[model samples]
Target: MSRITALTPDQVPAESKSTLDAFTKNIGFTPNMMTAFAKSPIAFNAWATLLGSMSKALDVKTRDSIGLAVSEVNGCNYCLTVHSFTAEHMAKLPADEIILARKGHATEPKRDAAVQFAKKVIETRGNVGDADLKAVRDAGYTDANIMEIVALVAMYSLTNFFNNVFDHEKDFPAVTPAGAI
Candidate 1:
């Protein structure tokens, strides 16, 4: 059970109505997280903007990989389930790759670098050493990619922390943690 109650569209603040509608129209239903976020319009709007902006940053596979890595590191089952579903259905990443990403690994070498870098950002709280920086650069990621990777990590970390704190009920199909069945 969720620690907080999820708001329906009619129950949410007026400012959050449009954003909630968009989510409903796009995904065919409002995510429980969005409903929970609706308790504060400022948080809802800010999160919507952050997610929209970051959607353009990296390829689907890379973005999903970062989400999976961050979610796993944060131990956010809610985010892990949502991202695992998106990674497979929307991003077309194979099941094996999705599992690897959740484990903070990647099959593709370049993507592996991004995943590892994201994991480091979470584990070290953005205090990565020189070698960590060089590894992604050596894998052919430009400065812009590096910045976006950091941004992605920050964004996912916010959601992970939110869901973990709230213990939000999972709306999507459940996903086990990386090592579990």
Candidate 2:
């Protein structure tokens, strides 16, 4: 592994410090991923706000399911662990369902659709066809929800690529380590 930088709030630029400060107060600490994001506060804030808004606007389980599917497909352990925590603790998705999604299984109709759609979107890389969207719609998502699904995929993709490139070791539970992907 490349010698990893210990990113901290104090080490961040002032504008990033303020944004990360809000995260620290709300979550007790800023995620290591966010500190990595401190490299460009303008981009970080935009991503953070979009991610936050998506979380708030959707059913938490749906959001987490899509996120998990994307991360798992992308092999992003950092994104996986963070969203897995959210899925289990905040979203309250069943553990079995989370496991199912992780392995590309559809545990139920609704979850299956979300995970399947996310997988297709990620695998196809924006080349998803109308049938994919139709399946997502048939699964009870609206056009707006479909957009959020895309957003989740995009968000996970961005973070995963960044983390993998920098070897952004996971902090929570520290399940992920310095070994390169």
Candidate 3:
């Protein structure tokens, strides 16, 4: 159960009610995290806006893949579960690919580099060595792509830490991590 109570649309402030409604209309339910964010509409709007902007930085598949990989590393069951569903359904990743992604790998070399880099950022706390930088670049990721990955890492980390800390209730089909990498 969520340590933080999830607010229904009727319960949140007016500014956040529409966003909660749209979430329900689009996804069929309000994610518990959003319900937590409903406590502060400013936080909700900031997260929503950042999510929109960060989403454009990478393809859906790559973004979802990174989410899975990072959640695995962080041991965030909520993220693992939600991201598994999103990766499979919205991103249209195959089951095998989803499993591979959680291990920081991909069928495509460029995407593999990206996931691996994301993993390194989390594992090393963003203190990657020069060789780490060279590997991603060698795979054709430009400086901009690298920065985007870092931004995505930060974004995913925020949600992962939030869910983990709050013990947020899982609203989607549950998906457990295979084990730590």
Steric clash pairs (candidate 3) = none
lDDT of 1 by residue, 1-181 (tens): 8899777557889998888889878777778987888888898899999999999997989999999999988888999888988898889999889889987889999999999999999989999999999999999999999999999999998999999899887898888864463
Task: Give the higher-lDDT candidate: 1 or 3.
Answer: 1
Clashes of 1: 0
Candidate 2 lDDT: 0.74
What value does the lDDT take at residue 125 in candidate 3? 94
Ranking by TM-score: 1, 3, 2
C-alpha lDDT values of all predictions: 0.89, 0.74, 0.87
Model 2 ranges off by over 4 Å? 2-4, 105-108, 174-181
Residues 1-181 of candidate 3: C-alpha lDDT, one tens digit per residue: 7788776657889888777677677777778877887778887777777888998997999999999989888888888888899898899999889989999999989999999999999989999999999999999999999999999998988888988888886789966554843
Evaluate residue 27 in candidate 3 and report its C-alpha lDDT on the 0 to 100 scale.
74
TM-score between candidate 3 and the true structure: 0.94
Q: Which parts of model 1 are misplaced by more than 4 Å? A: 178-181
TM-scores, all models, native as reference: 0.94, 0.84, 0.94
